[model samples]
Target: MSTKYKFHEPTAIYFISFAVVGWIDVFTRTVYRDLLLESLSYCRKEKGLNLHAWIIMSNHVHLIISSKEGYLLPNIMRDLKKYSSYRILKEIRENTMESRKEWMLYLFSKAGQQNSNNKNFQFWRQDNHPIELDPHLNMFEERIDYLHNNPVEAGLVANAADYLYSSAIDYEGGKGLIDIDVLI
Candidate 1:
């Protein structure tokens, strides 16, 4: 099943989520997580992306973002997924700390083999569900709050700010790895 959405305009905020194939816990390693962070940083610096909020979970990611130059949202997600997949797979192969590398690669390879044009294991699912934000200011704030609160909701941390991989710290006056552009 293809998971793609069409946006009629480019000026609105978008909420996007992409899950690991089979919902695997591939992000237990900090190396893979760092790869994602690095990709987001590169995107911000080179792609004109305006990242408003984000949360990197064990198996998925939630992001609230918009493009300053009106670039299509799908393109941004595609690039992010592709880059992260390559780096994470390479890390899995090269890093000695990843004990479950074989099993993870088997699962990823199985999923990739199920689909055409996949030469190796697939990390992320291809479908990105992008929800167009309501034009109201309050609605945007609510979505941002929801994104930031995800880790707390999952019981991973006591507060949103405690989660190092999200923009909640930035909102709470702490420095986050990625710079966030506040919408409100």
Candidate 2:
């Protein structure tokens, strides 16, 4: 609820991070991660989301995002999160192969009931913790490095570019899961 971390500049690129409620490792599955990637793709194609970079970790995600001339970054983020949450939750509910279905649903239900903003279930934590990139400093490079190296730091992969869920591959001149406007 603090204005310090809110999205104030609509056009300025932002380094944003959001986690699942209780930091549950919901994205451990390929289907869940692909669902998030699909949502990002939809936002980019329909909502004027200028995605600079992104990474989907086991429990959270980080993105370097901005918006086109007539779009608002906050609005795009809200829609992206809301839509992805609904779709992912539905998939989890309907997935007969999901072993953690009941447990995840219970946690989401409990979280939703506790938060007045949600009607039934809560998938993502509310705050995006967006930090506008300062052109005066090296914030862009710094954040992009941090974002790409997350999997490496977590021991998920030996090399950053080897992580398929991140933009590191794109940065390394390889095609990644989602389209990104690589920063120079």
Q: lDDT of each prediction vs. the true structure?
A: 0.84, 0.94
C-alpha root-mean-square deviation, each candidate: 1.8, 0.8
Instruction: Specify the highest-TM-score model's number.
Output: 2
* TM values, all candidates: 0.93, 0.98
Off by over 4 Å in 2: none
Q: Write the per-residue lDDT of candidate 1 for residues 1-184, one digit (tens) a residue.
A: 3434655467777888889999999787787888999999888778767899898999999998888775766677778889889999899988887889899989999999998858878889977778888866577888888988988899999999999889988888888987888766
Candidate 1 residue spans exceeding 4 A from truth:
1-4
Q: Itemize residue pairs with steric clashes in candidate 2.
A: none
Worst 10 residues of 2 by lDDT: 1-10
Best candidate per lDDT, number?
2
Estimate, for each residue in 1-184, the C-alpha lDDT of model 2 and write its tens digit: 4698888877799999999999999999999999999999999999999899999999999999999899998889999999999999999999999999999999999999999999999999988999999977999999999999999899989999999999998989899988888887
